[model samples]
Target chain A: MMLIDTLAQGLLLGGLYALFAAGLSLVFGIIRLVNLAHGDLIILGAYLILTVTTITGLHPFVAVLLAASLMFGLGWLLQTHLLNRVLGADILPPLLVTFGLSVVIQNGLLSGFTADSRKLAAGAIEAQSVDLAVVTLGVMPLLTFASAVAVIFALNRLFYRTALGRAFRATSDDAVTAELMGIGPQRIFAGATGIALAVATIAALYLGTRANFDPSIGPARLLYAFEAVIIGGLGSLWGTLGGGIVIGMAQALGASVNPERQILSGHVAFVVVLLLRPRGLFPRASD
Target chain B: MTPSRPLGLIAAFAALAVLYALPAIAPRALVQDLFGVLTLLVLALNWNTLAGFAGLVSVGQQAFVGIGAYAMFAAIILMDLNPLVGVLIGGLAAAAFALPMAFFAFRLNGAYFAIGTWVVADIARLGISQWKALGGGTGTSLPKGTAKDMAFVDRIKAALDVSSAAAADALTYWLMLTLAVAMLVAGHVFLRSRMGLGLQAIRDNETAARSVGVDPVRLKALVFLLTAFGTGLCGALAFIQITRVTPDAAFSVIDWTAFVIFITVIGGIGTLPGPIVGAVIFYALQRLLADYGTIYLIVLGCLGIAVMLFARRGLWGVFTGRTGIDLLPLTHRPPKSAAPQPQASRRTA
Candidate 1:
């Protein structure tokens, strides 16, 4: 029963990890370039939402709706201006550029908000819990999990069932071919990054509300998101969800034994998964 | 045919002499500042060999530094050995650690490899934090007067007639200078060697290189171990001056990797003199903006991004491309005897 309870809680935590990973998966799926600044961007979104809430005296949830749109614009501009210039055969430029962005964002946040950890207040929902079967779960965690599922479903729909999704896939498969077929690969790439950031904003909502976050923590968060994306494989969205669950379960289990080892265990799980599945659990057939 | 070769040799000797005599003539603060620059230059050189030449862009170099540091601390605290000996042990231990690290990280390709290395570094930090004997997470400081008793700190103190602290600083400063010079010379020689040519070939086209009998994995792994050795040695030397050992301080990604990466990127990625140029500029920028809080890094980050966007080969590359001046050339030059005199402009005749 105790084991079951731990697994249940782990599943909920996995939702948050999945949320963190979804945007990262989206950008890599289309562009095949991993954005190292991803974690910092999510934190930036959280800060944006927090700023809106404090100024407007709005609920954190409502504030995020505004933050998401702004983040989408920010993402669009970032891709159009900065990342687009670095895309090519040599992977060094993209990697280094994103790395520079990560440092810039962290320091920007540090200067603006200081290194203090901040959290969003969500009122009664903070204490709310739901009992399912033999396990009791937090209402917030349930909401986070449901949102993750919805985000994945929506993204899947956008990917396969929408024209933009086709463009993304077309561009992902071959940029030159897609360009010859009358698709603007650069525009498609910008759109993909913009959507990824909007999704990151959603992740930011859960992140800010769930725990305290500061500027320096971005790299570690980036690590977790990256682990999920890798362990899940490159092109599969649902696989990323599974990867997140695996990491979450590992951390929860480690925490059950020794709290200090919680984060380390998640990293260990990543290593083990990679050792077992080098291309990840569900690598894209083409990749 | 070019004057660069002679000029490079002259500049190299002059720089070495100046660096060697700085402690004697220059202020102690200058020695300390140059020490910092030299150490960063060493890190940048090691990173350059990995990312620029081998095409292995690893963000987890801090792992080697941290591992090297913890091993050094353990040697000093547990075995009661000299810090200089501990530094050698640090380098060896780092190389040993790199084998398992390479085994895991080598499985990843390109961007995944970078992430893989970063994850491994995190694991190393966490594992080191679990080491209770070394004070675990909170970490421990060296014994009182340990820096003063280091290999040559006393002898230098007597000769230079300076305080124990200044003597200690001088010892580290001299060691850092020697290490940086060694890396520069060795990097130049290695890049001009057959193995280095093979490594560059592998980077340019792995499949073609494989067809020609170049083993990418073996060569890259060797470079990884070599860089790990250099990084570890630098780390141990750094902590010797710092006199404290903490997991966070030792494994700090920004201090160990990010700034070094920035330095390399700003100077030039593949070339030997790039790190030196970058390190000098970096040290100048740091000194100029020393008053600002976190602004220094923010500026560097922006500059790094700008450099990537506009000048992919960095400042040194641009200089070399425009002026055809390579102070430290990595490319092959044919012997004068092999050149055809038929089309040559013979000024002597």
Candidate 2:
């Protein structure tokens, strides 16, 4: 029973982490470019929600939709105007360029909003809990985990079932061949970044509700996302969730032993996995 | 060509000597600021060597810097050595650690290499923070008396007591200026050597480099160690300037890599003086916009995006194309007109 409880809580937290890693994974899979700015973009999305929520006094869920749409546009513009040009054979340019973007976003948020942390007002729903025979779960956390499953399922279906999804997979497989097949690489990348940012918006909603967020916290979030992506293997969505569960369990277990070990434990787990599987747990066969 | 090289070297040395004498003449505060910026310049240049020329974009250089700073603080506070010597030794110890790390990390390709560096940095931080000897999470200060005993501080005190403003400013100025010059010269010489050529070849195409008998793995490891050595040295200099060391301050991955990336990208990657230009511009922008903290980052981001999209070669590439000036001259061969005459080239130019 106790083990079930631990697994349940970990899988839920895994949802939030999967959300964080989803955007990161998609961008990497489609473009082979790591978006260092991903975590900051999530923070940016949260700030957008905070702004709209405060202004309209809407529920956090409603605010999330607005934020997601805005982020989708921002992501599209960012790719079309900036990132698309730097995506190429050489990796350094994109890495350096995105790093600068992360810094800039963090600082921009810092200045726009003071360093003081803010959280979305989730009301009683946030405090509400669902009780199972063996354990109780917070509604927000359960929803977050469910959403992660839904997102992965939806993305997988979209990737394999729909025409647009076929284009995305085709482009990921071979951009030149996709272009030969009448798919525009630029348009596909723009669409992927847009979808990634939308996922980031959902992540921001949970991140804001689950804990306090300030500008400085984005890099830590990025660290978790990177770990998840690496742990699960780079391109697989299901693998990302597994990676997050592994990390989440490690942190929880480490915390059980020593509170200070919480963060350290996750990192140690990542390193241990790397030692055992240098290419990651589920590196893409093509990759 | 040798004669011209000597003249350049002498001029650089003379410039250093003159600057070293400036702290005596300049304001005390200004001298200190210059020293701080110079240390940052050293770090930026070293990062440029690794990420820029070698095509290895490491996001965790803070590992080396943090280790060096901790080692320095530990040596001075516990071992009772000359603080300056302690700092140098700290740098060497970091290099020793880096040598072994490079072997494991260099095995991974581009993105994996970067992620591996970050993991290594996190591991170092975890080890340091958990070890009570290093003050763990809260961090510890250097031995209290060491700051007063530092040679730079003593020199500054003497100048201040004598009211020799120019003399004090000059000494501090000269020290920082000399270190910065040495770092650049070393960077230049390294890039022009056989190892540097091998790194460039690998950067251009790893398969091709191996086809020509270049060991990509070994060359990358060497570059990693050398870059760590320089970065470690920079950390020591930073410790001297700040007079303290803390985990967050010393191991700030963000500060170490972010501004360096901006400088390298904006100035031009894979070129020696790119970081120098980037640092100067970055420092200037920071000073000018100190009060607008968040806006400063936004501007930096927008600038980076702009540079990546339009000025891919960076500000140096732009200026050089427009005006044809070669100031720092990290490029290996001169322009066609500047290259040796056909006869001179055949005669071992």
Candidate 3:
């Protein structure tokens, strides 16, 4: 029973990891750019929410909505103005640019928010839990897990069922061909980044509500999300969830054995997965 | 071609003389600052070799740095080795660690490869932090007598007529100076060699180079091992100067990798004098903006971005472009009298 409870909790934690990785996977899938500033962007989303809630005195959820739309616009502008300019045959520029962006965001946040850890106030919902027959799960964790599933589902539907999704797929396959087909790859990329940021905002909502966060925490979060993305296979949404769960379980199990081993164990699992399957569990066939 | 031998030799000797005499004329704090600058110069050179020359942009150089530091500590604390020897041991240990890391990391290409190194580095940090003998996550310091008993430390103290701490500082400065000079000389020589030519060829066009008989993997591995060894030595020297070692400090990406990348990029990567120029500018900035904290980092980030986007060739590149001066002369050019030749003919020549 205790083992089940632990596993269940880990699964829920995986949900949050999945949320963190979803946007990363989406951007990488559409455009082969890996945003090294991804973790910082997530933190930026959280801080945006914090600022919104503090000023407007709105509920955290409502603040998240406002923050998400703001982030979407920021993401659109960033991609259109900055990232688009750097995109090309050379992979180094995007990586270096994103790394620089990461630094800028981190230090910017540090200057703005200081180093003090901050968390969103969810009131009674923070304390609420559902008692399953085998285990008790926190309401927040459950919501986070459900949201992750819903996000993946929505992303999947968008990819397969929508014209924008077709544009994304067309652009991913061949940018020149997509352009010739009258699909503006630039605008598509900007839209994709905006959506990715929206997803990142959702991830931020859980991250800020579930735990204390500061500016420096972004890189570590990036590491975890990267691990998940790698383990699940790059560009696969469902696989990302699986990857997150694997890491989450490893951390939970490591914690059960020894508290200090929790984080290390997740990294170990990632390395192990990498060694055994260099291409990850579900590499895109096209790739 | 002009026989540049005498001029080069005289310049080298003059530089050495100035470095050797810096302790006498410069303030103690200035010597310490130079020590930091020299250490960074070594890191930038090694990183430039790997990323700039070999076309392998690794963001996880902290893996080697952390390992080198921890190995030095382990050597001193566990093996009872002299701290001087521990520095060498630290380097060897880092080189050893690089092999397995390369085996895995080399499998991935581009961005995956970059993050692969970071993941391995993160794992290395976590693993090192678990060793209780080394103060676990908190980290450990050098033994009480180790710093005082460092080889040549006593001689330095007596000769310099300074306190033991200051003597230690001077010794560290001299060591770093020697290392930095050695790295520059070695890097210059290597880039001028046949192997270096092959490495550059591979960097330019991997498939074409492979077709022409250059083994890309072998060349990359050699560069990787060499840089790791050098980076390890720098890490050991840096931590020794601090006289304290922590996993976090040892494995700091910002200090070891990010700043080094910025320096290399801003100074003009893939050139001998570029890192030198970059390191100087970086040192100047650090000294000027040390008080600003995050604002300083933000500025650095902005500068790095600007360099990456607008000035990819960096400061040295811009200077070289306008002046047509090749300071280190890594490239060979035929006299103007010679007619233009085909690529094949040029290679044969």
Compare the candidates by TM-score and give the number of the best one.
1
- Candidate 3: count the clashes: 0
Candidate 1 C-alpha RMSD relative to the actual structure: 2.6
Model 1: fraction of the reference interface contacts it also forms: 0.89
Q: Write the per-residue lDDT of candidate 3 for residues A1-287, one digit (tens) a residue.
A: 77888788889999999999999999988998889999999999999999999999998899999999999999999999889988997777788889999999999999999999999898899999998777889999999999999999999999989999999999998999999999999999999999999999999999999999999989888888988998999778899989999888889888888998999899899989988998889887345
Better of 1 and 2 by lDDT: 1
* DockQ for every prediction shown: 0.91, 0.63, 0.80
Question: What TM-score between 0 and 1 does chain B of candidate 3 receive?
Answer: 0.92
Give the 10-residue window scoring lowest on summed lDDT in candidate 1 chain B.
B340-349
Enumerate the chain B TM-scores of all models.
0.95, 0.85, 0.92
In model 3, which runs have C-alpha deviations exceeding 4 angstroms? B1-16, B334-349
What is the C-alpha lDDT profile of model 2 across B32-116, one tens digit per residue? 7777667777777887788877777887788888888888877777787777787787688779879757765765678767867
By lDDT rank, best first, the candidates go 1, 3, 2
Candidate 1: deviation at residue A174, Å? 1.5
For the predicted complex of model 1, DockQ is 0.91
